[model samples]
Target: MKVITKILLCFFFTTIFFSVHIKAIEEEQSIIIEVEGDPHKHRQYIEDYHPLIEVVQVYDTIFTGIALKGKASNLERMGSLHFVKKSYPVRTYQTNINRSVPFLTETDDIDTEQMKFTGKGVKVGVIDTGVDYSHPDLSANYKGGYDLVDLDDDPMETLPEQGEPTLHGTHVSGIIAASGNMKGIAPEADLYGYRALGPGGRGTSIQVIAAIEKAVKDGMDVINMSLGNTVNGPDWPTSIAVNHAVDRGVSIVIANGNSGPANWTVGSPATSPKAVSVGASTPPMKIPFLEDSFEDKRIELAPLAGSKPWDLEKEYPLIDGGLGEEELPNARGKVVIMERGIVPFSEKARKAAEAGANALIIYNNEEGILQGSLDDSQGPIDIPVAAVGKKDGQWLMDHVTEGEYWIDTTYQNIQDKIADFSSRGPVTTNWNIKPEIVAPGAAIVSTVPGGYRELQGTSMASPHVAGGLALVKQAHPDWKPEQLKGALLTTALPLKNGKGLYNPIDQGMGRMQPQAAIDTETIIYNPMLAFGKIDKLKDSQTVDVKIENVSKETKTYHFELPQNTHGLSWQLPKSFTLEPGDKKNVSIQLSVISNMMDKGLHQGWITLKAKDTSYQLPYLFINREADYPKAMGLEFALKTFSKEEYEYRIYLPEEAKSVTIDLYDPHSLVFQKTLVTLEDTEAGVIEGTLKKRNITENGEFIANVEVKTTEDKTYNYQTVLSIE
Candidate 1:
């Protein structure tokens, strides 16, 4: 028996190596091809047509497609084949996890114990770095799962002997259904792991899609994926797969990417219109801020991960430490301020600690506040380090230059505020409001591989909603996936920022209220309205809202009168009654006068009253063609197998007439050469490869992307690209 097991393991490792070796040998690019007919037959057709192309995997459950690897030219030519519908490059994704279970449940006044809906019998699949099922907290409910990366049934978390150890999946799983000391929201739910991402918490699109297909085949009731790439297109392959999974009767929850405080940062899978995308919000906590002793102006401080907490109690003199790249002047028992550049954040923190500094402050080089983490590879720093925005940093620098400046620490008890790092969105093409809701993600403690740890991200927030949905599913087993989603969105608590209510694009209907969702008798589909761009005067758009009376009693619904605003008029449906268990669709029309309205994004909320309960539906519209980026998310990298070949991808929100990428010397600003150009490019992601022959030099170059839209308007975006 031992000999047989050893032989099987050796064969598995060899198969994995051979698969990777094939792609590394040639200038082959991995791609997922959506097919018009059967995927299995399509795979065979691809092989017969392009003899050298290799089909890695076939998916049919969630998405009908085939993953293959071939030379760029061969792959491009395959697109012209009659059977092929569309092709997407297999982009890489990383595990992006956890938190206070009671914070989430208690915030909504949910009594899981009394409700008797602890997600019993619900099969929740977690697609991430596999779970550590051996942990005592997860053993009972850890049913079974598959490892897509290793092509095996044992979906255990990556161990040290493997490439890079991971605990992300375990943390997420614990948040969903752990039954031991660290109780999850859905403690009795059955847990299944789908190891899409392997070592280093990284994997390609093919693995993720295969895992989704497996989960669908396994008849999962709910799926939670805390992994995503930085591509924001709604039609991206992973996002499309998510939509298909929802159509197959599985509730899916995804983490809105952690690229936040900026619009259009929400990535794929989260961009899926049908998936429950979640953003990170703070649990009740006393957040620390830095205040100037003289002016009493306080600046919010986000502590760097892996650093000591900012808990200073006394005022300390502030000193400018330049960039903190080299040895600093003698400074002891004072806060050292550094600019973010040249040196790594961890290195600066280490230098500051070595100089006996009490704390360190690093400010952004750009306009917004810096969200950063210290590199743990260099070991941990002893002193507390925090980040501030560029304006505050400049103010501190000026104060230090003129006279002695003393800074004191202050604390503010905050709750339900959106995390600065939480990605915001009005998804590019479709204009849907992503992160349809928010949840407590900041400073959440959950199960890790060995024990418990506190972590925070939208990755953590997503599982909260997933677990909440599991409870809702247990209460209403007959509800469709759409109904399950509506329960959460329509009943969420609308949150507010310092200025006022957060925009619909930022908070959607707002923070999740699990108890309200479970007890509500009505479900509002399309709870967030996105009336896309209105270009002409007196232009009108209508959205049909689906409302279901899921209760035992008949319900009458009516819309509240919106505040009068110039240039916009709304046509609302009359009060109507729905019989028990019946659903109705009502149209809401909005007419806009472009010249009378401000030419920018306008947003607000519409209230709907059903019986004694009322729900707030967030609404948004662009008065005219707003100045959103024409082209963004440009990525350039050398092919893993061949250094001489480079692959690039850029996102076009709308169809463009032409696109061009030009390179120039970073230092001298001298024109190098045009990298690539395409005509009549579609509105999704455009990917291609560049050969070494096209470039005369190798090093860092500034990439200037010029995009000409079909409307004859041009927009430019710039980023740095490197060649070796």
Candidate 2:
């Protein structure tokens, strides 16, 4: 009896110790892990040994990979397995919904109304956060696809409560195949949705690879991945997988990323040499307005994330809420105007709601209108709230000397320019020109899960190319992926920010002219020219570019270099002609203006002028000897303006002796010439304010902040500002 009791006690203590000691992983996270040799074999190996790890999806054709779900401890053990090549946490992508509808391509003259083809029979795969397969605009053309996220047949978008649902997949699909009144670039193309990303717009690279392998196996003609992470290299697993897919005859178009205006920000997969990485561009002319009884002020209004739209027709007394809770007595039944800074936007809106206000307006204390969100807290906001540019908000506060001043809200058409937030590049390390093409991305309207909505980012831009590529493929079905990419690159239009040519880094090969791409007979084989880095001033390099004549007729071409922009000198062929189906390789030699250039990115364009068309091929080389920030290293943010006085926080690695700040009108792109220079700056967060100016107009502008060290090296940081 004593021996039996001791045995039972030992068993009980062991069970209790393990239950208490071992951390219970209640919520399992998904991951994609690559394996040596074959993923199927490796998966079998995991099932045999790492029994706790769940193998969800496996890829064998394009690459050996598997999707997994398991506890943190089990996942770590699985990663350590002998057969595992690599394991990465699944990441989510966020939808950058900032705009509304499909006029983007019309501006490029790629009108489907006049086109002979609408991507009929072309199978395009969208590897994203799944699509709303039943969206009326997309259903007719949806050919069905796989959902890697749920391991199901129906690839539908699912939104999580705590996460912001990315309507990205649906939006991208619409760009490729939406029909009816809102026509896509490829209005008749067949779309397959591969739901790799979950509702939160997040997915692992391996899952994406699995999707690519599936799409390739399913015989997809084109794959659109408007998703990426900041890997900035072509050797990443997803990039290798994408390259494999391309080799298997599928054209892949990826978003260059939305981390733009900065150099070397092009993310992975898009970093793949064969992929058509896209960027975003805005229209040239836009008219922003706020409806008012006195005058409809042309102002840039930033809407809060969860704030309901105001009832524009209703009129109510507008009261200033800057005096805080103590002044709530005067804000009853009115639209309370609160100054931003001390309290959070949600808190301010809540206070206004508590004060019995009908609506809320949070004005900036600095230069621009603020983009606030009432989403940080749970539950619905009771009042309609909006943010206005600082200048306009202040003018309203000062001009309303009488009672019951009410401002009405209305939406208007805004111009297309490079969105300040759009990702820029010379891909990292390689310094290759990225964002091979730009498309309308800002305020773009497309299909959401249930209906249509506007989302911004390179995500929107890539689908435009995907849809456009469908048209291209339909036009030249015999062309390979690179050839189609070549045609588009050579036929694209150059976009400028009003001041000067937008650096190639900001807008690669410029915007896409889809019609021109379809009509072009000649193609440049080397779409991107990366001179790499010229560490020494005297270094000279040579590269050969191949051009092909795709048309039945013979074509003549002459290559010319744009007058040396960055101390770059180039040799171009005087003239060359290609017979039908003929290919020609031309050698070009490049040398730096060695003595003339300071340490920075030096670039130039080589234009191939054909009989009826011309193509711009951009080339860039960096100087590393010169002390310059790694483009992404410099960070800064502008504060809301109070009157003409505004401030900014600039972060840098090296200590700065002085800072030279310049302002430019984003519309004009012209330097304002008024320099706000600061001296004796420290190494860390350097803050300074712009003195009050006589500026009264409300619009968007750019701050060209420059930091200089005692060594005379200069680094620049650019940011956008709104005058409310």
Q: What is the TM-score of candidate 2?
A: 0.71
* lDDT string, candidate 1, 377-438, tens digits: 55667899988999989988988999888889999889989988888888878888887999
Residue ranges of candidate 2 with Cα displaced over 4 Å? 1-31, 43-56, 68-81, 88-113, 160-166, 283-285, 289-299, 302-414, 564-567, 625-724
lDDT of 1 at 165: 93
User: Tens digit of lDDT per residue, candidate 2, span 1-724?
Assistant: 0011222222111000000011336566656666788777887888998888788878788877777777766765653467765333222333422232234344354444436778999999999988887888888999989987666677888766736565779889998889865788898999999987775676655567788988998899999998886546555567778888988899999998876565666767787888998888764424334566567465555556556655544556777788354448777878788777878887888888888888887788865325445653356677877777678788778845555576655556555477666777766555678878888776566787766654557888888889889988998899899888989887888876678667787788888877778877788878567877776657777778989987899899897657755566777677988898899988877777666777767775677788757677777777654233422211222222123354433444345677765656555466555445678675533455555454444555555666776678766665554443
Top TM-score model: 1
lDDT of 1: 0.82
TM per candidate comes to: 0.85, 0.71
What C-alpha lDDT does candidate 2 achieve relative to the native structure? 0.70
What are the Cα lDDT values of the candidates? 0.82, 0.70
